[model samples]
Target: MAINNDVLSIILGGGQGTRLYPLTESRSKPAVPIAGKYRLVDIPISNCINSDIKRMYVLTQFNSASLNRHIKNTYHFSFFSSAFVDVLAAEQTMQSKSWFQGTADAVRQSMHHFLRHDFEYALILSGDQLYQMDYKLMLKEHIKHGAEISIATIPVNAKEATSFGILKADKENIITSFIEKPDAKLLPDWTSEVSEEMKNEGRNYLASMGIYIFNRQLLIDLMSNPDTNDFGKEIIPNAIHDHKTLSYQFEGYWTDIGNIDSFFEANLGLTDSIPKFNLYDREQRIYTRARMLPTSKVSGTTLDKAVIAEGCIIHAAKIETSVIGIRSRIGKETTVINTYMMGCDKYESLDEINKNKTSILMGIGERCFIKNCIIDKNCRIGDDVRINGGKHLEDKETDQYVIKEGIVVIKKNAVIPKGYVI
Candidate 1:
């Protein structure tokens, strides 16, 4: 991978992430734990580091306390290198009194800092996407084609196109038309050319991945319009005709884990025989905080294809196809299947656990049955509790739980009463 020090990278971490509600209730979307180890913000920053782009700015607004801590603890540069990854929280100033309204607006507000450096292009990325790409190639193509704006696009299927910004690029890959979250009826006219193999396999639609390469000046000029706040809805569609906008297609393992079902599947998908996304890649390693903890102690646990992170303790529990996160504690007789337990932040010492002998101790209590569910960090599942996800519930939020994308999402730090069945 070619290094580009002249380009600045920006990771958009400011979204409220309402679609990922309970997970976003306390921390920002990017701060949400993923795959039993890393946070969502690590994805984009890791990609930038592997691509050799050093300078980075993460824009955040909602519940940034934890996000800021994670970034501070994880990314640090030696004095020998100029690489820096800093978080730019939203604040009111003399120039602007309001917070970031959309993605484009967030970048515009933070442009002052990005422009202070002598960088040429700005590589804008999403915080919730899961993938790895050599942005050096994308920037090289942007400069090679003399494009004012180059968008990173991925070929998505029709079912997935409705949630994304679909586009149409002409013969030379210059984008001609774009639609933001087009309805299923409108997808017919927005189709692009596809290969015969893809035609036979059914992956055909070309969707904008919300990743863009912008010539610093063009981006600044485009942001002059106060109405162009959103990149997909207001920015790209208006710039395609006026600017030399090109499409850089990316064929990689990219998935938007912005919703409950997507998040659930993405975490559990890591346990597959052959995971769609590889986290163990040596070259493009996903970086996170270096936690010094003892090895996970597992004794006679009936485990099958589960990913148990460090600092976890599992007694004779039965876990199958689950991703138990760092510092997890599973009691005996608990059967967890197809679940993503984003384990506790810290372990309860034995004395503390003994003190709480009256009620169920922290972590999964004994004899609990959990399936197709997402148990957020610091959750206390009591004994005889059954979270078996049988019915397909959607967008139903309550004090006890929420069911979105047909998956039961127990809110973070929630406590389930003993003998409760759902």
Candidate 2:
């Protein structure tokens, strides 16, 4: 088997997603549920596997148990010994402090693993995103250009440009200026310095996709520097002035699912009449943990544009534009609309006490109504409850729970008693 030399993949899965609130309060942002079934980590891992990059590592911090389990089960490319996929955690191994302070810090902590590889280049990416591309082609361009660092970039409309890092490049596709999330007024003049020659030569201005490929030695030396602690805030921007930094144009279906609004929007995108993401591609299959279970059976139900996973029993529930997870049972006369429910596995030992404990896991508990709410994994809801998320609107005063864009998040393991309405 001929191996592709000079490239390695590192997925940044650290960072406490405080903005995401209760969803991320327990697990890292990358482990947070998406579309009821998939986690944020699944996006990048699927991309890497489809792109034919065998050896990859997920750098993690914060709450990592769920993230680790998802990686282990979903990414089983290692069933064949020739392939290697791993989840790397922050460790205190004879080299400085343990915790990951920032993105660069996380990579620096895992320097030993990269150091062992014979590959000369490294591809660094974030796990909390949805995109599909042939990274093998990207790597080919990186090596062909002799770039010390090559970044994948996309152009955004000027109005929404402030949300992302803006890039300024010169004529030869050489990146000169890189800024992570600039102000709105700074947008107009953000890339004003670009010469006409650069613009005419198809290399005017671009925004980074937060994807990077770097020479191994250059990355190691840069990461080891005391001052360079963050990739976005520090390292990459500084490298432009000193190193041969280049930009690779990325025209694909890419989305940053970092916050609640974006997360919900991305899931909605998947279920569009003509989806931007093509899941049926046999050539580039997006792999997930396929539990050997029976197909989802809708018991004379009316499902409208809803994604139902394996082992689900929808008993006459009018599911519309929603995403339901595995092993979940929907009771009679239920109307689930614009909602996401991550279900739990069925228990073999079902005692009376266990029945009370695992009510939500088993079924919707008769007449429990949920509208416009995101119910997380393993939650229990009792009978005759009318919970509408319209009550708690987005507020500026308190940080308790803000319902921005009308998406309400119910935390894991929470129980709503019978007839309780929100």
Candidate 3:
């Protein structure tokens, strides 16, 4: 792809991802693995790359080691080309010796580096979303409208509208008002005026995708304000009244993988006949680290509509409607239904496996019945373990696992003892 040097991409990777809990317990939100082999950071970066926007910076703060490593190893640009993907970790400054307070604040803090480059537009994106987008089209709209900032907006339903920052745009697509999770009673007022097609389809509202292309100087001035910490909460809402902010209407498959339940559903959605976010799109493919591993070997495993990644060794496991990650190891007589096993980083060697056979175990145990659960990376499940959703749990945390939105999540590197049923 030819490089577009007019813009500089800034990805918000500094999020602690508290909602994603144990997944974000060890690493930054962006570092969390997705689908099977790809990291969460890969989605936005890939979008930028595919969009021909070459220069990029990933802002990270909490648990940045793994995120930094992944970026360093996965992305490599030619010396001849000016394209680069860099990580900007939060740091203490003389003027303010504090960490990034919010999304806008993170960009505000990293202004020095971004300003150093000669770019007209600053493309800001969220790290934890599943979609494919061409940002160049957005850039064109920003230029055509003669706007100070161009926000990427998506048509959403009323139920999902409650979670997002809703916006009302005029016939010309100029944003008139911005509401951050408005009251249910006031929803009708905030609902967007869409086309007849969209109205008939039940998409009555427009929500922010947290994607924005800002005029360099406008963003600099906004970030300079001490009160403007978050983009959705303060910055965007105020900008609508003052600046010429246009809504670049985006009609595509976009999901904010905010919590465990949404994440689980998104993963399983890929296993369907026609997934919302098609990962198999060759033209607009989701890029990730190329792991050089042997092909997955499955013996006596009945996989019905499942996406089993590379380097997996499955033995007599009946996986139905699931996403088994790379380098995964499923033992014999295991029935995995509606589960997401984010496979291990490396396979346990024969020596390592033999030494840790008794007390320490790795991978799925025999006769394990894992249904509606997410087994994070490097988890150790012992014999006859059951990860069936014990009860209808909502936003509950535990020592071994967490139940978010009624879906159980076995944390990364956690161990489930022999014959444990939970």
Number of the candidate with higher TM-score, 1 or 3: 3
Model 3 C-alpha lDDT versus the unseen true structure:
0.88
TM-score of each: 0.95, 0.89, 0.96
lDDT by residue for model 2 (72-93), tens: 7776654645456678888887
Q: What ordering of candidates by lDDT runs from best to worst?
A: 3, 1, 2
Give lDDT: candidate 2, residue 394: 56
Q: Which ten residues in a row have the lowest lDDT in candidate 3?
A: 387-396
- As a whole number from 0 to 100, the lDDT of residue 186 in candidate 3 is 81
Model 1, 1-422: lDDT tens digits are 22577788999995899888889998999999999989999999999999998889999999999999999999998889878999998988777899999999998888788878877788999999899888988988888888999999988878988988888988788899988888998887887776666667566778898899998888888877877789988899989999989999887789988788788888999999889889888988899999998899998789998999999889847899999999888888889998998988887877887787747666788888988889888888888898878455545777868877667788887888999877
Q: Which pairs of residues collide in candidate 1?
A: none
State the lDDT of candidate 3 residue by residue for 283-360, as single tens digits: 788888877999999989988989989999898469999999998988899999988899998888778878876554
Ranking by TM-score: 3, 1, 2
Each prediction's RMSD over C-alphas, in Å, is: 1.9, 3.9, 1.8
For candidate 2, list the clashing residue pairs, or say none: none
Q: Assess candidate 1 and give its lDDT.
A: 0.87
